[model samples]
Target: MACTQMNCSKNGTTSAADLTDDLIIEILSLLPVKSVCRFKCVSRLWYLLISQHRKRLPQTISGFFYPKHRYNNEDGLIGFPTFDGISGDQKQLFPDSSLPFLTGYRQILPKDCCNGLIFCLCWKDSPIDEADYVVCNPATEEWVVLPDAGHKSDALAYRLGFDGAMSPHFHVFQILEGDEDYGYISGVNIYSSETGVWSYKENGWGDNEIQIVDMRGVFFNGMMHLLTCEFKILAVDTEGKTWRTISLLETMCVGNICLGPLAFIGQSQGRLYFINMRDNDSSKLSVWILEDYNGNEWIFKYSISTSQLFGKLFGEKDHMLQRDYADLLLQRDYALVAIHPECNLIFFVWRCKDVLLSYDMDRGKVCVICSLKYHLYDTFPPYLPYVPSFLRIGKPRVEA
Candidate 1:
């Protein structure tokens, strides 16, 4: 029997097989992000449809990538970058963590990750000045080697800024160090993907005394926010036309010391967050959110102690062992790795124990995620939070 297409819907119902790709995408877009991610496993077609339309749908953090250093007999010092997946289905989007597409480089050191793009310093076998700044997207395997910025690598602090939902273009900022002061920022070199050129601006920040404390900066609300030694947030836009500074809470300041602040800045759920240890008490960690962006007001959101975090993990410890553990906690041996983009989960690395742990601010619970492979020495390794995006960067390249 030759049944007509219109006759098949006589009962006002459509079969699963009869649904078109666009129809399925429309339905998936209405579901929660978790449900939309689960549909990826329903079929290969569903995976492709969702991935293609990911920017329109809500996005969540997939995992994190941090450098793991090892001494190879042949290569001397080498970095083996590792990825720790937090989402099951999303992890499948990036099969290879090594980033094999970035070829012909002695080593690739990831400097910063904003949105879905990673900014890396690709060291060549030639002189240090000949190194290249490479930005790559793992999901699409698209990469682009940027033109030289005409500045020495040693004197520059590089940061990547991209927001796929807001715009397709991305920017790279190279902050230059002052020649005489050495601590103050002398100038800035910005590269725009849309213009495909580098632009220079000399210390638009206006305050030469406020030195950049950390190389990592948080990109939020169309501005790159950097923590300064003065315990203030310095922000600059892509055009270098507008500049703003938000003062940190007076209690968080470590006043006039050469040491960097024990604080980190990150963005989650459309707000800027600052996490730092209490200056008076190192064991107490405080989380603050910029509730009023225009007014520059920071509201204290959560606070937790070292005992509350690691107490359940180490139960019924001996007196001697407990004493040693308390000493380690007092010394602040943990490093804050990342903050969940969608929730109140904070990820940190316990250097002394070499384990990754996540603390839930809402539930007041702490859980160990996994053990780290590489041994961390004096300095903490760069832990970059990654949100998977199917956005294409440059021209697609063949898999290496």
Candidate 2:
């Protein structure tokens, strides 16, 4: 951590300019993401250094964005306040005006966030003509409109991916569901910011055995993991240009455990994890890991008991728990919102709750990280783990 120009002579003849570029980059990378972003105005050298090291620096969960939880929709979209994950403090209140491009749009739906850029479905006043997919970099306040997929479908889901440290470009994957003669047809379309073009692969999913059930996708190790209604996992390989499905064990589909909403798939430590919140009992959740892809081997990892989670989170207030996570959620009125892919943590949002809670799987501890400022009544809002960056879309940078 030594300053490179510390030995320079006193007369102000030497400054940060006298320091080696490598040393400056090393020093700047040590600063917080927001601080580094502000220092981009210092000079072109600093801008390049900060932009290059943004991804290499420690990647922390910056905040969460929920588009659904707002006071009113008539007075424009109310910006949700984001809180810090580490400090459990309010970070910033994002107003609608800040995203000027979204002005006049009736519905602003967030699809995904990857390396700081957000992929959203912006539907204008008219449902047909103005509906389009937009990519926005909230940190830089820059956005780009993606080209159309050339066909219409009944259902749609999207996933975003980028490596800002290695490249300024990013990619978006669109999974479309439509009816066909057989039963259903699912297609995959890819949009690249670098090329400004949409590549379509019809019948992306050959078999109609199980269609993608939801929009939430886990992007890990160059693949996007999607869940199906039949307790199956669909992986869209962006690099390999292929789609494959992984079936859950028959034991997972029998009885109340077969319920799809009671389970979720998360990636941790470079592997896929299948978590099943017990339906009959709210006091436990089962965790499974995918050991082999081809052989379809899933090894049981461990079971997390809610007895401790409940005692720690809700205190000594005990009640009869039935119907598993939902009943526990009804008693405690806490909703299981999301799970982090890079770590052993699960996020929960309570009914009429403003705060976001994180439970560490390894430590068996739960703590408040931030506030949502919105209530979870019928459904959880469109939420995603966001990590801010200084990646510029139009600005020239090396492609990864």
Candidate 3:
């Protein structure tokens, strides 16, 4: 707390050369990274302090708070409402589902989650009317939107990714829809919180004419994975302006196996697993491992005939929402840990509710972690990871 001063009264006459780098970094830690970044423009000392600590700031914050949480930071992507309609745009914390205090995040779409913040994009008209792309922290309820990346076309694709290194960083890849031959192609623009502006460039290979655009970005294997199509997974490098593809499931292996939609299964122990459910209209189910983001290997696992997890996984039921419920999610441990009310009409009487399960990455099998209404198998006790929705004070520091 004493690392940072209230006003940093050392701005004007005090030459930053007089202060040791360690002391400068310490001061920045006492304050929020966002604040340090904002103050970087003041002088070289301030800039160094802010830039030098940008990499360590997130770690510092995570270390400080991860242990403090009942669920810690090892759980899956915590789902919570970003926009409140019933509460009239209120950012107040509530306990209906996710952590009560995990609110105030803008454009809360499931694109990419890193460290402690989630990134999203919002687009529309202009200045007084134009929308924005936001990267935010639900825990601290902090958010920052990106500036436009010189796009002339209305169609655009924003993919957020993270790179793991000494200075692990998160970046957004924005692909503007434009002509590639006539040179109107607005390449993948990069945006970093540490470096606020989006670097303009040209579109990379296989990054054009994407028929299926999956807004749900999966950060896996040191790259960002997005379901580009049933046969391809677009992987973007978070550190560089390069985009590539990674094979999830081979088309020749299972005749007509398609890549399922991606969702955060959970990040237990030390791995980040993506839950993808594949359903068939022939009254059958299949689940595949979407590969864990941040892992060190290219492991693609699949579960065929997954009728065990979600009863009635195929046939007419699978084709219900051709596009809506395209695939089923293999909810894993610590994920879907709480009550998830969605998709009614399960087993004719039991409503379709989200449940927790243990996924065998090696065997493609799923074991229920909680009890279901119909006792899909057997009634298991629910897990209470810290009481939901308790007003924990802010991170003990705040300033505009």
Candidate 4:
């Protein structure tokens, strides 16, 4: 946790003064990810220095500095011979492609990834403990399934996030029954990934009245943001072991806005965006970008309105516009790679691929390249979790 500096050898010849901060940054940027991580300890300046220079670095190196999320379009969502772009249909693309890496995965699906792992929570007709929690790496295609969440028929809610700065690198949040009283709501527990175990349980997280219909937890700026459709965003500091609440931007609450379906678009660079259901119209989409989320303060700086993606991008090859888009695949802001919407399937039908577009976020503009699908879907639990004597928080703590 210390940021003090140490003397540098400078190849055992050049004096430390001979190398300027910029010069050292250029050199470190060229080093392998491992070396740079170790060399950061040389000084806090080195840490900030490398962090600042991270973006300009080549993809090969920057991919390590900050693990890149697989842009759904770039990861070949439709994959292989088909290569259908983002806004394509599923049946049209499936003819040429094989089963998606995660074809059969449905309910409680993992629609996002971080570091190198993805989360999967399977919900059957009932909770029977066949296979419940699974953490996998699509890159390595490796998986780790946790023990039963210990939820009987009474698990009210559940969520997954990471706390690298904490003992256990990952944490699972769950709300379960409180007492024998009918639906009194008992405890909320967080399961740690590092320890592969869960904490006791707490209360008041979600058992009040507002049900978390659509939940997307985003870990950014060293914290986890839990997006719910109930009009409130629960932010938990994975590293700090605390929870706070954030609200949707007022700009997003206009028109046919509904409080039951919200989503965490993703964190790009260092900011987080939340996409919520605006109006029933398929053309009015609104999203908010927030930064400086240091657990205590969150600043909403960017608000984006849906502009027509018309022309060749939105229409067919012949420029015949078909579906009017009410959604976005933010490239400049493209961090949510696991989002698989029904509209994406439509993209397959259209045989789309590698289409270019411009990402305009009110003040800034960037060139972004991504594919399109004909479908759009949200990845949240469809039903409320059952309730039971789920272990309450403060139950007990085991050493990590």
Which has the greatest lDDT? 1
Report the candidate with higher TM-score, 1 versus 3: 1
Deviating ranges (above 4 Å) for candidate 4: 1-112, 121-129, 138-142, 153-158, 163-168, 175-187, 204-207, 238-241, 251-265, 276-283, 294-307, 310-312, 315-400
Q: Give the range of the ten consecutive residues with the poorest summed lDDT in model 4.
A: 342-351
Candidate 3: lDDT of 398? Answer: 29
Ordered from best to worst lDDT, the candidate numbers read 1, 2, 4, 3
What digit string (tens of lDDT, one per residue) describes model 3 on residues 1-400? 2325432344444445557778777676556434665777988867776675554442311110110112215333332222211122222332232323323332123344454445543433233234556655554454565666665664455665543332334577665657644323245566665566666656565445553333345455555555544455556565546667545443321112122122223232234333333323322332333344434344543443434434433345555443334223332211222111111101101123433244444444444433322222122122222111111222312234
| Model 2, runs deviating above 4 Å | 1-56, 68-90, 93-107, 125-129, 165-167, 180-183, 204-206, 250-261, 278-283, 291-297, 317-335, 352-354, 375-377, 395-400
How many residue pairs clash in each candidate at the backbone level?
0, 2, 12, 53
Q: Tell me the spans in candidate 3 whose CA falls farther than 4 Å from its real position.
A: 1-112, 120-130, 163-168, 179-186, 239-241, 252-304, 312-351, 354-400
Better of 1 and 3 by lDDT: 1
lDDT of 1 by residue, 260-297 (tens): 33577888767899988766776667899999999998
Candidate with maximal TM-score: 1
Give the TM-score (vs. native) of candidate 3.
0.45
Off by over 4 Å in 1: 1-56, 87-95, 125-130, 152-156, 179-182, 253-261, 318-324, 330-332, 375-377, 395-400
> Which wins on TM-score, candidate 3 or candidate 4?
4
